[model samples]
Target: MIKQKRRYFSFLFVLPLLVVFLLAGCQLQDQFNAAMSRLAATQSVAGPTLEATKAATSEATVIATAAQTATAVANSTLVLWVPPQFDPNGETLTGKLFNQRLQQFEASFPEYTVEVRLKSENGRGGLLDSLSNASLAAPATLPSLVLLQYRDLESASLKGLIVPLDEDTLNVIGQNWLPYAGQLSEIQHNLFGVPFAGDALALVYRPAQTPYPPSTWQELSTQNLPILFPAADPDTLVVINIYQTAGGSLTDENGEPHLDTDPLLKTFSYFSNGAQSGAFPIWDTQLADFSSSWSLYQQQSSGYAIVWASQYLQGQLPGNELTSLPEINGQKITYAQGWLWAIPQGSSQSLEGARHLLDYLSEPEFVDQIDQLAGYLPVYQSGLDAQTNPDLKATLSELMNSAQPLPAGSTINSISPIMESSTLQIIKQQIDYIQAANAAANQFK
Candidate 1:
């Protein structure tokens, strides 16, 4: 009975303690809710510090976005380096076309800017040497875009200085560019450039003097009239014109040098024979010194001359009918040559702006401009179709259809100087050697 009574009292004491604990827990919960409500009210009021923090975060985001946009805009400005072929006069077709179009491009694309700069080394200075120096110091005053010769593509590409353009960019330009331009873009399937300019061998003749250009070497040899080949030292240009007409290949598939010695020898033999026969003219020393290559044909003393198509077209003809050179075995061909525009290998602006420039140059309308100004045949069908002048259009159509591109590789570059030198020398040597051989033959016979 005593134990039961003590147990009951203990239970009563513990129940009071449990109730107190419950009350304390409830009170703590109420205090936490009240504190949360106070915080909500404070946030609703939006104190200056809180508002400032939010505004600062938003402003920072805007600043970050603006910085990113500015960086992109800066990147869109292309730094282009063009070869020094253009004189300051901007008189020639090449100069007029490039400079005028560049101005138009700038005005059209306000979002993009093109900075035309001069290349330290180009043409005469040597492309490979310039490219090497530029690669070592890329992205620092380096050209993001460059206008390079088509012939130098092999060397530049092999050195890892240039990047292959994306297929989209290539298709946009390549599908409609000139045929030779498209050919120059690839070297064993690797693309390196876009066609920008071209000049081909043409026969400028005066119909008033010779009525018709000879169809064979015999006619040229038989005619007593003086004929000029310009650049008395330009034997290589003449030789290549002859060699290509004869379907000669200077390089093989593996990039091996393959000059057909027999063709050169045969060509030299012809020159020797022709000079003795009084078929070759000795009056002119060089092609350009004679008031342009076409000046040879324009000369009243001359009947026909082989010259650059662009120069001839740009020249003022004096009622003289221009036609392709006389045919050999009905082949009826001439030496076709031109240049491509390429970005430097290590150019930083090569990504987007450079691509845009290339595309602009390669577009059909731009190609038409080049054709009209330079007298270069447009490689793209659309450009030719757009031509309005009947005579020019007809001539360009014939040239484009008949033109065959020069072989592109290091072999062409390697042997170009040799061909130039050898041809010039051979022409000079032929005169003396042929006369001596002729005299010696008579004595022996």
Candidate 2:
């Protein structure tokens, strides 16, 4: 009886300890559950970061690599790189047409398989950047042909990334291409690209705002009305155009950028008159590029807007009418820029194919339809006549004849800053026309 009582007391003592251990275990489990819940909530709240983007890109690369399989390489493959605006597989009508054209080219030429890649129009990973990088590190992967702006064409030629066209290629190009178009690709008298799509400045105005648009700088300055342009553009296209309109030469015989005080004074005299007269308002000076001025004009829609023919046409906004630039000394003139087809230095074996493609693209029928749809001008004389609208045809023809190619990239790069500073000083009335002229000219010396 005594032993049984002792054993029962021992069981009661152990039962209390077991209950304490069970309570501690429950508390620890609850804490762990709370921590796990908090962790999930934090994860949900956090959005994708730069690190996530890089991780995703890496995963995609891994997947792509894993998917690759050994296969027989095609013979006579040609690779082409173009800006996004010219993407062949995009949803726009222009893209559809371009894609169809590529397919057509491939169908007609069975031996050649064309590969198209889209690149940004400017900046890092753009045409020039990729071209430069590939030229140094991945030469074998260099494109057979590339579409580049005239400025880039010059830079590419200077870098020796793009090769100059032979005499035979130049001769063929000269036969059909417009003079200014040919000039777009001419670097140091060597043809580095084949010009295809042309863009030029045009005057846009609302008929309701003004009965007749100003037809000359004389009229434009004296009218004392608002006119919008990128006066502060880093490119200093305004300065270049006005100086050229005053019969100034942008380059000397040696192909170096040159400036003369006479033309500079004449150009600034107009800015002086306009700024003082309010024809070119102080608010207009705030515009740093064509886009800002164009956007401002859209909201107000009361005055004249000077923009690229491409920008205006692509906009297709109602009530605004497009017209030729004003007459300067009985001549209709403006600055023109273009896109060109260029063969890379590594693409020697594909020269024949590249030239063939260039010739095919420059055909009047194709150029007419494509340029018209894409708000671009054809670089061929024949393409000019192909426009169905007689008035547009006439206007484009005049522009084609009178418009000059923008100054070479190197020339503009060297001269723009000096001229821009002086032009701003003149517009702001911080200096006289003579002072501005002298200031601009002295920089070149």
Candidate 3:
């Protein structure tokens, strides 16, 4: 009976050892299967991994090295913040094109991957607002790069929300960039943004109704056809155009606004007289925004209107003629604005990687695609010449020559409301041109 008990105890000990051995074997098999699966998937996509094998390495060392390499590649990622207009999940044409470009960018740079976040273009809770919130609340979540309009660069830079581009980076882009594009990116002599897309003001007129298109504001004001323009829009581009055309300076020597000058009075008087003479339709009251003014032009309610190049491109206005704003003192001048690629101050991505991606996107080839798909003009001069569409090419060429980068410190947000109110008062005949211009100018002071 003692010998039987000893055998049974021995059996129990052996049984536990056997169970441990089985469990270990199963774990080894699982790890082996996972490694093999990963290898197979890599080979299928990348075609035979370029991993080098050491002549005298053990199997365990090889596995460890491969695992480390995979982890490293998995961690290389970039996050980009774009407007909702470029959201890949959306059905818009630009969205699809941007997604395709993003895929190509990833394929071209195998070591890095990109994730896109969509943000609203405008509003209290928009891209800029979100950036402000993120900067204050959780800066770690800020994007590696952001696409923003030219007007935002000054405010963003002043607030320390974006980093300035180094001279070397600027040199690389400056080689092929248009003069205005470079100018658009500069803030107090520092480059804080890289121009990607551009828009300029142009005159959109119906050729059937008006055989001759006016070349200057003076001529446009004297025309018999009911001229329409966004005189009341908050952008105040029309006001700027007129003010500049009449030899008015946008700012004084102290960088204060020079709105009450003789040139401004003359420009205002031209518009006020036009309103009283029935040359300009009383559409300012109805046109509180560009879209409303554009709608009026689109519905053929007016013979001519001033519009952005994008609007003209999108409208494909039939039987219409597009020309640079009428020549003032034999000089054609128009305001130009652009969207830029800016790196936020607290981005987690390596500067080298972010710059590489931006340079790739700014290539002439990529800019060409953007111009073709989106209505924005290319930042490169060569891209404009390469356009296949004759009409578009001619119009862009003329505008490009006359295009002036929006003046620094001339943010429309601050100046628009004042200009809009003054212009509206003048149009309503409630205030004389001198009085209105002085009032608008004083607000800036």
Candidate 4:
């Protein structure tokens, strides 16, 4: 394994000397980009394995083209675009923390100025849209770096809106981020982004009512406790999480998107049982998103609810406590997605400065602060250590460790409706779980 991993490195490297040496002339550009494939292989060396970049493109090449502007420009301004939740001027503690970090970046590298801009998370003038616009209309206006959702990163990379990261960054990320995080930072076999903040599904419950969160469906039924979750979410994320936890595989023998009927039956049967026990109310069908379900749980102080780690952590909602998802048997499971920092595909003049800022933001201290203050799961193992509280730290470690990257949109689209329909039917007592599971599986077959 070690021998195979060494193939990612073209040669041993030293940072300061390499940057200066590479910048000396255009003649060394080819040598500077000795191995573009290493840009993504860092994850493989770190562990669970990953694919190498298929194209012969690397940040060195990108930076090489604009090396003169980057070094000779004297004072350079690096622009960063973020969503409203990350607005530096906002009152949120996480926002304030970011503002402080940006200030620190400028102080550390006085030769560079970091400019902040706000963009919506989606839709008109959003990060993706604005990236597309700026890349076409005014290449110079493109922000040096942008924050993207894992799914959006896939889109941005596919459309050539974002560029691959350098090998050094991926090496650190592979060693720092949790396994799922490495997966999140990677898309289409390439390292295109660095995970800054991440989120995962977890259980939120009223501590006064239940001393310990139940770890199995049988316990919930035996205790006659109902857990509130959005059975109506179009994505069927809750069901998927539960299904996978019950030892089901989301892919078939063919390595394609699939539904395992036995596990589906087991999960749906829980819903059917819950409906009779009043663990799930008729109104659950009306809840289509986390907000509505979370609000309902708060109003009723209901037994349990499935919620995003961020929603429970960031909102600081009263009267509830967070824990890992209800484990099925001995295993706990959840799906995760997160924000990433990506360089927009444009002039590389700001690349050097942007990388500096990216490095600073990815520091363990900074990541720890965000995990505690911003309601995000720590992306790094060290960041997890920053939790401070032993109990919360232990719980988060287990849940985050259990997390897997949320599947692609196409996979979600294929399986969600079937899961949602079967789940709702069981909750509404419309059909036997066995029949429903069989019917759903037949569609995929």
Q: What is the alpha-carbon lDDT of model 2 when measured against the actual structure? A: 0.79
On the 0 to 100 scale, the lDDT of residue 322 in model 1 is 57
User: For each predicted model, how many residue pairs clash, with residues at least 3 apart or on different chains?
Assistant: 9, 0, 2, 1
- Give the TM-scores of the predictions, in the order they appear: 0.70, 0.79, 0.80, 0.78
Q: Report the C-alpha lDDT of model 1 over 389-423, residue by residue, as the tens digit.
A: 78767876666656655555554555556555444
TM-score top scorer: 3
The C-alpha stretches of model 3 lying farther than 4 A from their native spots are 1-74, 89-93, 169-172, 409-417, 438-445
Cα TM-score of candidate 2: 0.79
Model 3 residue 252 CA deviation (Å) reads 2.0
RMSD of each: 10.5, 19.4, 12.8, 22.3
Find the number of clashing residue pairs for candidate 2: 0
| Whole-structure CA lDDT of model 4 | 0.80
On lDDT, the candidate that comes out on top is: 4
lDDT of each: 0.61, 0.79, 0.75, 0.80
Which whole-number lDDT from 0 to 100 does residue 376 have in model 4? 85
* Candidate 4 wrongly placed segments (more than 4 Å): 1-75, 136-138, 169-172, 221-223, 317-319, 347-349
Residue-level lDDT of model 4, residues 170-223, one tens digit each, is: 334565778878889888678998888888988888778887867787677546
- Compute the lDDT of residue 273 as modeled in candidate 3: 75
Model 1 misplaced stretches (Cα beyond 4 Å): 1-68, 83-111, 118-132, 176-178, 230-235, 247-262, 283-301, 408-445
Clashing pairs in 3: 215-326, 216-326
